[model samples]
Target: MAEGGYIDFHVHLPWREHDPREAARRLLAEMDSAGVERAVVIAVEPSLKLFKERVNAETIRKAAADALDYLVYMRIPRLRRILFSPEESLNEHERILVEHTRRSEDVLEAAEASGGRLLAVASYNPELGPIGTLERIKGKRYLGVKLYPTLHFCTPNEKRLRPLLDYMESEGLILIVHTGCDPGIWELPDLCSGARPSSLEPVARRHRDLVIVVAHLGSYSALKPGIYFDEALRLIERYDNVYADTSAVDSFLVELAVERVGYDKLLFGSDYPYVTGLTIADFVESILRMNIEWRAKMAILRWNAERLLKRLGRL
Candidate 1:
């Protein structure tokens, strides 16, 4: 790894607002400004096929309102426990719908154009046939697959996802799973349960060969801070292949993770566009300022992720 250069394990192409090619260029500029040598740009697909038939103008309107409320409460932590409450969980007839989908092709195209400054991670919605999804990303240049169990309304250990996990492990690809709560309609209790880090324990136990990076350190939600922080730490401590990322988590949790599992098990991730008001440099600075050894800071900021990418032959 280059001196003073760190890898951002989690970042996203601005598929919602800008063209992926343009978004890639903008991300590179930001990285250059932040001293980020490389980043893993994740593609996301929050849209669900089961809810497609039920989606209409009214549902979309309600979804937008839910998203706005979530954003507001995120900015004001006090409002989370007081004002924010969904009347009902997402059911068959009523559910949140996101029209936009970030395709893996767009992410790959952008990564290909980044001159090795970026690595692509494809997104998978298990509801959309897992085997077919596997076939789609089989020969692609993706470093791994990112799974949003809470957003997709599924669990990591779902039977449908077995084939995909099996294939990734066999091919030496990594698995980045969303192990914390999500905002908007996903904040509901039912959806939140899906993202619990405990649900991933079985998957980790079964697929010991597959490298798993638990995103958000299993405690990213403003509404419920550190909800599954302990569970995430336990996995990292118990499984050699299981690790956690410091994306969208509080600084104290990072300290706690180090105390409990040490620096080698932690990776630095900025969550990028979703981090809001913070640059990749800001995250790097936070780690640098931590009350730990200089070597630990370097491991978290760059070396840890550099080792993973190297194993995958991406470096």
Candidate 2:
């Protein structure tokens, strides 16, 4: 790895069921072999009872603390708890909703237990109920908040959700949102056709200072080869605070994103364990070879995350 260069973000981890030590060993090995400098592990714990590790807007964190605990160490690859805040809109059991709260504590403890290798991304619907979780978790350490209107089943345009967005903006927290087509997956049928990128216009219009992260590369459509090229261009043009990540996005699409959005607004991420680190690294390195400056490439890989960490004061 180049001096001081690292893979800005990596969101995968192993569970008690999977083994964190082994996951860490494997991750470290992979990074060493690939020359990936530093990496970020966004701890996640999925809702297994939700029918087979099904991922949705509600399960935004994507993994459990037990699993996330696997990757924690003294700190070879920095650990971050992508603290997933579960939503109750789809959960009738209230028990299921409370589970997210319980899990948040477990995750925080686990992150601290590893001596601080975790980060949290609390996600919830503003219209659902009082955001006690946000108020409570504020003074503590966390990366920011992640939002998914397309999956948790909220219209980003809803006036009801605005207050929460406004609050987040004032809090100076980073927000991540899934823009574009969610695709039809059996587990999260509701997200198959959720809010589109344009729907975010209302929130973006209101909270210009909020650091918004656009995930899935805007998942656009109607292009000749079916790329999000236009959508990426549009979102960057519309929101100054808006940033895009490489989560679950393909290599070709990643290049398109870099090509269209430029390097500054682009951040490197793997949505992790959902998408492998090796797969992501392959694409990033490939595109970077084609006349892109090393500085810009490094910016996408590290500086972007550094900026967010500084904003969150996580240094």
TM per candidate: 0.85, 0.65
Worst 10 residues of 1 by lDDT: 81-90
Off by over 4 Å in 1: 1-4, 15-17, 48-100
lDDT of 2 by residue, 12-100 (tens): 44333234444555555555554555445443322334332345434533432433453243232111222233343234323333332
Quantify all predictions' global Cα lDDT against the true fold. 0.79, 0.53
Number of the predicted model whose lDDT against the real structure is largest: 1
- TM-score of candidate 1 relative to the true fold: 0.85
Q: Evaluated with TM-score, which candidate comes out highest?
A: 1
